[model samples]
Target: MSSLKTKEEGKVTQREILGCLKNCLLLLSD
Candidate 1:
């Protein structure tokens, strides 16, 4: 159960990092 929770949290953090990277790229392109 703890492992599952940690995996979920990692996924969420990965998604957030990806999103932030996308936003940064967009700003650079502009």
Candidate 2:
């Protein structure tokens, strides 16, 4: 791939996005 990225890095990004999404949902629910 031209972009260049490691699997571990992808996993970490996914986790951060998920955490942000979870926090947003919680705030909306309240």
Candidate 3:
């Protein structure tokens, strides 16, 4: 159960990081 929770958390963090990276790229392109 703990491992599953950790994996979910990691995925959430990764998604957030990807979103931030995409925003940065958009700003740079503009």
Candidate 4:
């Protein structure tokens, strides 16, 4: 159960990182 929770957290963090990267790219393109 604890492992599952950690895995979910990792996924969320990865998603957040991807979102930040996307925003940065958009700013650069502009």
* The candidate that achieves the highest TM-score relative to the unseen native structure: 1
Give a tens-digit lDDT track for model 3, residues 1-30: 999999999999999999999999999999
lDDT of 2 by residue, 1-30 (tens): 534557778889999999999999999999
Candidate 3: where is the Cα deviation over 4 Å? none
The clash count of every prediction, one per candidate, is 0, 0, 0, 0
Q: In candidate 1, how many Å is residue 13 off? A: 0.4
Off by over 4 Å in 4: none
lDDT of every model, 2 decimals: 1.00, 0.88, 1.00, 1.00
User: In model 1, where is the ten-residue run with the lowest total lDDT?
Assistant: 1-10
User: Against the hidden reference, what TM-scores do the models get?
Assistant: 0.90, 0.75, 0.86, 0.85
As a whole number from 0 to 100, the lDDT of residue 9 in candidate 4 is: 100
RMSD of each: 0.5, 3.2, 0.6, 0.6
lDDT of 2 at 17: 100
Off by over 4 Å in 1: none
Arranged by TM-score with the best first, the candidates are 1, 3, 4, 2
